[model samples]
Target: MHPYLQIMIGFARSGVLGYGGGPSVIPLIEYEAVKNYKWMNSDEFGETLALANTLPGPIATKMAAYIGYKVKGPLGAIVAVTAHILPSLIALIGILTFFYSFRSSPFISGMVQGVTPVIAVMLFMMALDFLKKGSKGLGVRWAMILAVFAFLLLQILTLHPGIVIAIFLTSAFIFATYRGRKTMKQNFEQESREKVQ
Candidate 1:
């Protein structure tokens, strides 16, 4: 099939089936982008996700646009974002009255309850995968500590997520710069010693 059609189908599936809003839709998008299409690897997807979180607007649309642009450029981005949102738009318009009528029904409530745990588990698994990758760079102990610190900042202090992300990004930049300079200096010093000997 053509790439555009594939993009349409992939994003449409994510948009339509993604219950519980943006956060829940992320794993579905990841599956399509990383596993199914092979557009990017997990690491790339994780990095894109982090960057996307730092930006405003809906996460799913941002991801769709990025993946589309990567695949087929500007037109592809337009197609991808449209596909992602169209289903939800049509469904909302078609079912708004029906949903409102049954919103308080036991059947509807039970369905929501059943789906909630599944969404939670999906999110947990995704986080675990990211944590494993993060541990490789940060070390397991530091990874756990940072995870707990993030949790406290988010849950206890009620800090905004964007602020927390900014703090971490700034720290990572500083640490990486320092480490690079240190490595360069050590290499230079070692070469000088060898020349003198």
Candidate 2:
């Protein structure tokens, strides 16, 4: 089989499995592109996931584009993105076409209720995975604590998600920059020591 074909199929499957949108898609894409395909390491995957979330587009598209670019450049990105989108597009069209026909059914609503809790569980697991990474750094830990507080405030004080996102993003950006500067400084000192020896 052609490598590009494999890449497309990989992305399509990931998209199909990622029913809860972008955040849920991360684990699936990571499994295929990083673990199975060996296209990148976990750290690279994590960083790309972070950067993608900050960008404007869908997380799935960003991931497909990034992985595709890494593998086969511009054309690869196109192929991966199209593949990721096509399955969902087709499924959505099909469902919408039939939605009115099923609108009055209790069965459909029951299925939706059943699925919601499962998706919630999946998201909780994903959060734990991120928290494990946050545990590695004091800044990350504190930032996460602040985020939780802000979230609680949003719920209790009736603050909007947009406001919460702004605060969280601003704080995260500052903390990440500080952590990056510290890493660079440590690297510079290590390089200087090596040169002296």
Candidate 3:
């Protein structure tokens, strides 16, 4: 198959199989792009995800565009994005048609019920991957701890994630600045000692 076609198929599979939207799609994309195709490494995938999250568009689309650009430039980006959406587009229509055709059927409802667990599992796996990757060292590990605590508080205690994320960012910035200054001062002292010698 053509490269573009293959890329398209990969994305379509991702869309069709991915459960919980953009975040959920990451693992699928990583599987295809990193594990299967050897297009990038885990670190590159992390960077791509960060860039995607930082930008304004949908995460899945952002990834599709990036991967597509890597493989085939502008046209590839377009093709990948279109393919990523195509499955959902078709699926939505099919679902609607089924609902209309079987409005009274318990079978359709039961299928929906059955799929919910699968979606939950997929989302859980994705979350685990993020946690494993994001918590790199002691500092980041602590950061992850704080982040997760904040998230749990938000979810269970009716706090907001925005506030938690803001706090994390503020704390990180301050800590980084302090650490940077401390390192610089230490370096300066070492240089002065050498000069005296």
Cα lDDT tens digits for candidate 1, 1-95: 89999899999999998998788999999999999988899999998898888889999999999999999999999999999999988997887
Per-residue lDDT of model 3, residues 71-105, tens digit only: 88999899999999988988989978878899778
Question: Which ten residues in a row are the worst by lDDT in model 3?
Answer: 159-168
Model 2: per-residue lDDT, tens digit, 32-148?
A: 887888889877887777667656767789999999989889999999999999998899889868976998799878877877777788778866776776667546767588658
Runs of candidate 1 exceeding 4 Å displacement? none
Clashing residue pairs in candidate 2 are none
The Cα error of candidate 3 at residue 133, in Å, is 2.3
* Comparing 1 and 3 on lDDT, the stronger one: 1
Evaluation by lDDT, superior candidate among 1 and 2: 1
Clashing pairs in 3: none
Best by TM-score: 1
The collision pairs in model 1 are: none
Q: Each model's TM-score, in the order given?
A: 0.97, 0.73, 0.77
Best by lDDT: 1
Q: Considering lDDT, where higher is better, how would the candidates rank from best to worst?
A: 1, 2, 3
